[model samples]
Target: MNQNHLTTLLAVLDEGSFEGAADALRITPSAVSQRIKALESDMGRVLIRRTSPVAATDAGEILAQAARRMALLQAETDVALERSISRVPLSVAINADSLATWFQSVFSDVAKWKHATLQLRIEDEAHSLTLLRRGDCLGAVTTEATPVSGCDVRELGTMRYRPVATPALKDAFTSDEGIDWADMPVLRYGPNDAIQESDWRGRLPERPRERRVSQIPSSEAFLEAVRCGLGWAYVADLQSDPLLETGELVLLDSTHVDVPLYWQHWRLQSAMLQDLTQSVVDAAKQHLS
Candidate 1:
């Protein structure tokens, strides 16, 4: 495949539109469209779907993955040969909870590395593997233990989550007959978040008739919502520990969920990627259960 065509394809996908891609590539939109057309003709397949915000077809995803890998290798080579002045971009996916806690240390360590730049895509741990499979990210901190094709996996340890709420909310919602599942407000990270539901599924006798749920997507804000008596939530121990000790938040139940996390990355022979993996493993050791 032509390098310029592949680069143009990536720009369009990354920027989400041909016009946006033209701006990114410093070329006319007509030029961008022509390159894409030429590449499609060469490949004999429709790669990009011409929709609002645009999307890659199955073949497009495959090509995009290859393009990203090629870009990484070229960037590494250029830096090694002193032929490029730009730092290598390392894209990785991480969950919101991990980003707000154990993963912060990874950022701290990476900041000291001068030749690499970190680009993070925050997704739910269970779904982060999608980004890896799509090649939108080169590495991921995910819940899936099974490795994607051409990738390697490592166990990072378990993240324990405790059902917690403010004292006032707990007292109001619980009694001697057992806690009320219905009518009590609950918190979730987002629609994709199953942490709260999974934690309650095994404990409850049956599904509640009515569930009052508030979706707070931001990690820091989600924790704060729990502290402010918005609702009960299954919070990671990393964020709940200090609050539990200080009586700012109360554990609502004894049963806890331990989510095992793993680091999945492309099987590459790059020093920067290896260094990043090592840094992540080291940080996970100190924080996760």
Candidate 2:
């Protein structure tokens, strides 16, 4: 019933596990469990199904939506009241790839401040706009060419990706030209992350795998998997550069995934949103190469 309970429930639903949810929310799993129990008791129904990967029951789905709405409202209220400072909390919905590649510069620039807090939601670019529509986020970095209704848009930059692999994987590929790198365990983004994948296919003479070898949802994990030398993957150039320099990775070819990024924010009169957008835009120009 309380906002804390709603936040905890939302965390559990977003993370899909008690431990992950607890880690994200900065609370113990026992506390998360208690919050969910209290919420279920108030709602008079079992909300989330207790399973390996947690799933929302029909009722839980309703609560999940409601919780997101409430979190937005409360966070906005807090932001509004604490607006005396030059910096304010900025909640942004962003695709994993951007967070992995370019947005880190923006985040790092803001981290030095005492008053700027960012609540980030990891989502697909294809769907990040929905969070803006629901008022759950003030800004989003998205791939959509058109701005969401009732929002302002600014081009942050474009991200380029290339097919890459470890030296061992590359050697293996070279050893047998008959071997399909596509069939090789290629780390991929969750769904529809193939903008880069398509580029890789065109760059290659032929594809061996009908589908990706592995699908990783998180940016950090995807890059880690590739670094661990478990598989080849399409990596954003901005993100791949450091790994390449460290000799931990190498590019397979010049083929690239070029995804244009746009910064979208509510068209309302929120100074914090405006400042955050400008900060990101400035950061992009410096680091999105």
Candidate 3:
């Protein structure tokens, strides 16, 4: 494969358009288009889809992932030779709740490393593996224990979420038959979030009908909304512990959700990635159950 062509393909995908890629590569838009066409001809496949903010075909993703790996290797070589080199990009997917809590330690640790730059894609823990599969991220902090193809997986730890609400909200909703599930407002991280419903199903005889739901996509905001009595939610113990201690939030029940998280990354022999994986593992041990 042509290294220049592979680099061009990655540039186009990253910039989302040929013109943008041309500008980044210090070349003409026509030159960018021609290079893409030449590369496609060589590979005998349509690697990119022509659309607004263009997307890569599956073939393109495979090559783009290869290109990213090659770039990282080159950066490492440069560092070993004591040659000037740009910081290597380390893209990883992480869940919002983790980002709001224990993952901050990873950020602090990365800040002191000068040879790498961190790029975080915040997705739900259960679904972050998709980013890794699509080559959108090099690694991910996901709830998936199964390893993705060409990747290695390690157990991080479990994050515990408690069904909690403000004291006022809990009192108003609680009754002899337990809290009024149907009428009480509930908070969720997003439509895809089912922690609240999952907990309720295990505890309740049947699913509630026409339950009121509010979506707060951000982790910090979701906790704050629950704190302000906006609605009850399965809040992470890391964030709720202080509030629970200060009497700002109370557990709605004895039930808690324990989500096991795993670290999945490509099996590569790079010192930078190894160091980063260690940092993540160390942090998870200190923070997670």
Candidate 4:
């Protein structure tokens, strides 16, 4: 396996275009194309789909991950030899709620990552594992306990979300039969978000299809919207603390949903990754439910 070609392939995947990768590497675009072609020939498979911005084929994704692990080892070796080291940014995927709540705590120690740059890709907790499977990120905070192929898994902790709304809205919706959620405005983070919907199904006898829905995509904004009586939302316990304390938000129901979080990473022996994994685990222990 040619390391240079593998590195070029990963660069193209990361940058999403040949010219973009060339600009980052300070090489000519023509040179970048040649390297990719050589790599495809060596592997006897097409590696990139030349779209508006390039995308990797399945084989390309596998090779790109291999390149990442190889680069991590090489950087470690160079540091050990007292050679000048070029830091490759470590890309990770995480859910928005985690990022909004406790994700920053992982980076509090600068001494632990002086040689690395951490890049975070945010998605919903249920969908974060897709980024890992596509090799777009090396590690992810996800709801998936099952490890992706060629990866290791660890339990971080559960994130509990309570059904909450403004005090007036909670009062208006409550009845002898419980909250009248069928006609209430429901806050959804995005189109794919099913947390609110799931909570509805578990508490009520029907689905949330007939309810009025608002798309408040930003996590912080979502909380604010719920607090302002725009609608009911399942707010993370950590994020709802201050609002609950100030009586700005009121629980619609005592029933809460617990989403179990797991850390998934490549099965590599790099010290940098090991340190990062431990930092994340420790932070989750201290902060999460």
Candidate 5:
């Protein structure tokens, strides 16, 4: 089978439709279909599910991943052969908090090179590894310490969060001894957010049966909501320190939650990957616990 077929399959999966892939690859939709059909015929299996937004079959996923790996290796090979000075794109997944806080510092020096492009896919720290598992990115910043298959995991550092609220909220709770914590409005990033509840559980004797959570998905917006006294939340210590000092936000407890982070990347023998990994580790050590 032609290697180009695998590349076509990847394009189709990335774009989510035949026409979209055609547009991206600068090929006609008919050509795209022909390549896919030929690839599937060569594999002797149905590789794609033929959905409106096309999805890969289990077999297709394997081939797609191989295609991605090959592309990366080929790019590196080209760089070495031609001694290319052009920027090479590297796609990575990272959590919003890291992006908001310390991620940029990791690439500060590299950014000046102007020969390294990063395509960042932001997800929660706890979930970023799913992108690596799906073969969507070459590297990820995640809370999971365990390495994914064919990947290496290195501890970055610990990030700390503390439960905080406005001074007014503290006054309200003090006046009501029978106050149900659940009824009090809580701030959360999304449904998957466990920081608020987890902190609550550790501080209080019992878990709240129900929580009146206000969802603010954006990390910046979530911090702003907390600053504006919309609701109490577990804000990153690094982010909330200034507010806490100024008495804009009050720490409800002295207890701190530490989330250990890790960097996971494909176990490829590539100099560029090694340089990036070292840069991340050095920056993380400077910023995190």
Candidate 6:
């Protein structure tokens, strides 16, 4: 069945009237009627229960769900064809932080809609590799040093972070704690971040009191909190560049943490994965240090 028929059926169920469905679908009522008739004839069943506010017949509900799945699969197929070579599907598991700040430009450069069957899932970097190990994704941008079995690994480089603060907050915090990082309130990306714990403890003059902690799950929001003066944060280089230039935030000191990243993928001879891997590596080489 065509997309038009599937969409028409869904719209009819949503709007609850043939006329209303037609208006929502931007098709003539006759056209909507024709498509529904075609779907009914094709399925050999009465799919919709016609009413003032319509409902799907049992069969209609089944077909509607199937149609929704079909549309999603079709989109995947279309993206694969337009994105990369045939015979390979593109899918990935990644941390939300990387997706929000740095990874989007990789897709923008491909310039085709059907190049690969792109599947994307978001997880934390501390945990994304589990998806690959379970065979869900072909590759990942992760902090794992140990490669998953059947996959090869490459060092992508690091995301450098330093403590940062707004001037006013720094002034108040310094007055209270005397500019020692150990005693300051810090913002963490998540419980598993391990970043500041790795970098700051024992290195600072005073033992860290960690006055208060705030954790924002997404990369974008975590940085935004720092930019808004919520707390001191370990914002990455690429993430901090603009804020530093604009003078919204300042580096706490020369001390920084480098979150060494790696690239890992199934060692399969698929053209689609190969191209994607190469592109991502190229981007990493240019952007990460």
For all candidates in order, the CA lDDT equals: 0.92, 0.76, 0.88, 0.85, 0.83, 0.74
After aligning candidate 5 to the native by TM-score, how far in Å is the CA of 76 from where it should be?
2.0
Ranking by lDDT: 1, 3, 4, 5, 2, 6
* Tens digit per residue, CA lDDT, model 2, 1-289: 7888887877787688989999998889999999899999999999889998898787877676566545545555665677554335477998887777667877766776556688899888878987776556778888886987778899878888777788777777664555455556667776677564565566577766475567777888888888887788788787778889988788776666677888888776655566678889997898775
Q: lDDT per residue, candidate 5, 1-289, as tens digits?
A: 6887887998899899989999999999999999999999999999989998888888987777678788777777777676676445577899878888878786785686445777899898889887788788889999888899999999999989988889887667654464346556788888778787575666578756675678998888889999887888888887899899999999876777888899999898877778888888888888998
Model 5: worst 10 consecutive residues (lDDT sum): 174-183
Assess the local accuracy of residue 7 in candidate 6 as a C-alpha lDDT between 0 and 100: 78
lDDT of 3 by residue, 1-289 (tens): 8888888898898899999999999999999999999999998999999998999999988878787888778887877776766677888999999999999899888898877899999999889998888777888999889999889999999999888899999899888978886678889888678687676667668766677778999999999999999999899999999999999999888888899999999888988889889999999999998
RMSD of each: 1.4, 6.5, 2.0, 2.2, 2.5, 9.7
- Model 1 C-alpha lDDT per residue in residues 209-266, reported as the tens digit of each score: 6778899999999999999999999999999999999999998879788899999999
The candidate 6 region of ten consecutive residues with least summed lDDT is 80-89
Candidate 3 runs further than 4 Å off: 200-210
- C-alpha displacement of 244 in model 5, angstroms? 1.2
User: Tens digits of per-residue lDDT for model 6 on 88-196?
Assistant: 3456887766777667767865546344556688877778887676444678888997888678887887778777888777876575536855555678876677776
Question: What residue pairs clash in candidate 2, if any at all?
Answer: none
Model 4: lDDT equals: 0.85
Candidate 3 clashes between residue pairs 3 or more apart in a chain or in different chains:
none
In terms of TM-score, the best-performing candidate is: 1
Candidate 6, superposed: residue stretches over 4 Å from native: 1-89, 110-115, 180-183, 203-210
Q: Answer with 3 or 4, whichever has the higher TM-score.
A: 3
lDDT of 4 by residue, 104-150 (tens): 78877534655677889989888988889887787999999999999
RMSD of 4: 2.2
Better of 1 and 6 by TM-score: 1
Error of 3 at 36 (Å): 1.5
Which regions of candidate 5 deviate over 4 angstroms? Answer: 83-87, 176-180, 199-211
